[model samples]
Target: MPSRSCPRLALLALAATLALASPPAARACSVCGCGDPQLDASDPAAASGRFRLQLASEYLSMDAGTEGAPGSTDHLKQVSLRADAVWSPAEWLSLLARVPYVRKDLTTTGPGAQGPGSSLSGLGDAELGARITLLSRVDLGRGRSHGLALTGGASLPTGSNDARRGGERLDEHGQLGTGSFGPYAGLHYAFSQGDWYAFASVTGRFHTVNGFGYQYGEALLWTAEAQYRLGQRVAVSLGLDGREAWADLDHGLAVESTGGLVLAASPAAYLSVGGGMWLGVRAQLPFYARLRGEQSVGPVLVGGVQYQAL
Candidate 1:
């Protein structure tokens, strides 16, 4: 039988997973850029749990820089609803999948614009992946442990690539999907000593050209955080997350303003509501952004719930 004390570790893992998985939907650029892969320190082999589910929502609003025309208003607001599932079939391995529903509103300030804004809602790209624990150590008497794992996955082009508004074709960046497949790989490490925990990871996503002869830039994503368990039912964390990307390619030509670097401060809290359920919220405030050409970025807010089913 799995230990009921697992909720403490389960809550930590839930908060960590939510923080890592929410950023990909928060970007204001053409490509989804970068975000953390879904993996954490919870040890299923240690009698934590065998299966879990998470539901989360992410929100971001951004304004474009004045590059094309004077007195032009280009702003974007996006909200994503994501459902993630994790299954631990073996002690050393975990399999996961994610599905997303996206809604976007783009408002432009310009002459001859179609209405005040355009809105689109649809299913986004879905992902499938696994995590392999490479090493695990535990000291039962000291209540200290650490683990290292390898994580990788791919995103499927399940959403529509070509979307039109007012009979006008939307730009690739404005489309609901990339229309191409993406593969990603990363490494994760976590350490816990008593009520204090630390985590870090780096992931890279490789992009391919779509049928439209457009390829999004490859992205590098990373995160580092520290969490403190206040008691059996509460925890708080603070960390830094960031991304770097190469310029995107369009018909073998680099697209201007398509790639850059962004770094943010993340603070989060989690609470156990009892019966294997946990609630968490995180805020990502971009303190630094440097983009090519004319582009701007904004903060992201995320909230979610996790349930341990098995």
Candidate 2:
């Protein structure tokens, strides 16, 4: 009784079963926001055993020019607290440990502050590490990735090296720490594509102060960063860092230089409502800075929180 071509083949089989039951569309970006260009030698989860935890805070200030008093000025204030631990055991190997606490304040204006005001606090130097990743950019394909990591470290003097001012003491470049024994090395490179990212790093520190008379020393640090990703979770970063500290004063004197500049920001995606999470927020400002030549500018703030266990 129903034949008009069987009601047009039952309305084309009910429109092919309503297009196979619908549902399937959503992906503009969200895999934590997605920008993953590549270069993951690890650090941000690479499998094997896995474990990560970090907490950080850093603030540093400086103004210098006092070898023989070019205009007389030496002021520095530093506060830092950092704790980190990572373990991967394979997938490129990962094992790093960090612990730091520093507080120092030194001031010398005009006649080299030959009269008052000087301060220095406790626990300011401690480091021990290991990181190895010879090649990785997520194995080469998938976006654009690359990785090379090598670090060997040692730094421990505790803090306070007499710490005084108008009453003597204070040597070792005006003590607050650095009683000697410091060795460091670092290098990292990264590039991403999905959300965009770029990074570069170099670090070096070699010191052996022992007698506090100054003789052998070295310090060089450089960093560059760029990031953009406003989606899966949120990401934004801009950075430039520089430093040069060399010393060899015994009789020959000469070599001495200090430098600085760091502007940074990374806000969002580090949020964990309760038991853990709040992984990002780093703001730093230091328009330009110099040490053996004296100059000053300020702004430094840091916040942190990161945890993973599953």
Candidate 3:
């Protein structure tokens, strides 16, 4: 006879494994929401449900040094906590908001290093957006469907931009916000048949000059993922993420080491914890990078809890 406790034990084991084995990663760029927007589940947005709420955390570590230089010297670590909410008052439209808290620490080495490093923690930029379903085809009986959505949003200049260390203002990269508004637009598509699902998205973020006459680079991001449901409670996903950023501008001059292209492979798992709740973890491993200048990027890890009602 099948034990009643078997399912419960499996759930606990999977949860524990994910918590312990997950590393540091993120769903998007470290400073911007430049990639996938869904969290903790596959195709939740496909339902056009009433509301969804998610809380997520991400970690990343970076090391920087001179290009071709024998040894790297500077290191940076970042942690972010975010809250995302979506309200779908109608079947075709959904309004969304995202808010984040960020903590950063930089460590410098070598003779040129300045006083060890700098650290800052505070609120990051907030985003408000809306998603409109442009196309939808449903087959409830056969469990097959197709969905297409258009997403548009803007990032508010709400976080600190003039953070300082030892009386010197931190650079734009070190601050929590850009102090300038950022606008983004994207398209998302999803297809589901039986227990298999696939998703793809393309997004672009545009930036403007800040108070200090510094402008961060504009970015283009894309993602594609395939998910397989393991029975009713568990799902696994594999995906590819790609990003390309234009060079930054300093008072109208190109800033080196500020933009590049990166491609990564992501593997993720999600589990339904009952009562409309789901838990998920994803790891992004960069397999290729073509940076314009001397800088080293690192892997990112992210985990989240989500609740939704349909």
Candidate 4:
């Protein structure tokens, strides 16, 4: 154990460095919601006529790290906290609502460490949806079963609009809201047997023109996940998700470098406590980004606590 200390220390040092690194400047984007594990809407663990409340936090850093301030840098950062509530009216139907608060920071250095930095923080769009289990678990004989579900939702424009700084409007990434309503639909499938589980989902968001005459591109999202139960109190999961967004439109015309595809990998873990309480954490890395122009999105880290009726 004595020899392991050095490697651990090195890793910590690297993480610290990454934390301080500034990310490239980008527009504020609240479209990317919390990296919730996309679990089955109709959780088998919860009985019908129950409520589940989940609270979560996330943070991400972007751009290049600087040893210290005093040099020019272009980076962005995001932090958010969210609450998700689910109500199951019956075994096959669930209603969901998600509310989030977000804070965004961007730094664009001019000369030395003395550069321009922009900050925006406020409530994000709220989402309301319903999920129905079209097919519940079907025993395949041999400790195996599968389920299917459908989900539909809408996002309300309830946050502050972009703030003008000296005759310039900060991009969407800098604004608190899109100033438009968004609607979405999705399908979910799950399979489980013994200690292993698998899930897949496909979702799409249809964006509408906001008050600013700008609209984020429509987004198509999909996720595939697999999990393994380690003992009774612990479960670990891995998933990959991809998003393809059509180019954003400004004044009804496509904006340069406004749309493309982004793919990420998520590794997560859950710890169950007594009384139907649990803790979950997940990390996402954007391994692939294909955009029209110069664009960048930071990594995302998520942690949450939840309580469900047994």
Better of 3 and 4 by TM-score: 3
How far is each candidate from the true structure, as Cα RMSD in Å?
Answer: 3.1, 22.2, 5.8, 9.1
Which should have the higher TM-score, number 2 or number 3? Answer: 3
Ranking by lDDT: 1, 3, 4, 2
lDDT of 3 by residue, 79-129 (tens): 888887777777778787778888988766766566757788999888788
lDDT of 2 at 161: 60
lDDT of 2: 0.46
| Per-residue C-alpha lDDT of model 2 across residues 94-197, encoded as one tens digit per residue | 66555556566666778655765466656655555656776665533454556666655565666656665566776344455556666666776655544555
Model 4 weakest 10-residue run by lDDT: 13-22
What digit string (tens of lDDT, one per residue) describes model 4 on residues 189-256?
Answer: 87766666677888877778888898877777777767766656666777776777777787888766
Off by over 4 Å in 1: 1-10, 13-35, 39-49, 65-73, 111-115
Native-to-model Cα distance after best TM-score fit, residue 247 in candidate 1, in Å: 1.5
List TM-score per model, in order.
Answer: 0.88, 0.28, 0.84, 0.81
User: Lowest lDDT 10-mer window, candidate 2?
Assistant: 22-31
Q: Rank the candidates by TM-score, best first.
A: 1, 3, 4, 2
Scored by CA lDDT, what does every candidate get?
A: 0.70, 0.46, 0.66, 0.62
Please, what are the lDDT tens digits per residue for candidate 1 over residues 1-310?
2233433543554542443433332222434444465543333322335787888888877665333355554677778888887777777888888888988887766763446566889998887888889998988887777888898888889878888877876766667788998898889887877667777889888878988998888888888877777767777888788888777788989865567788878777888787777788888777887777666777778888887765
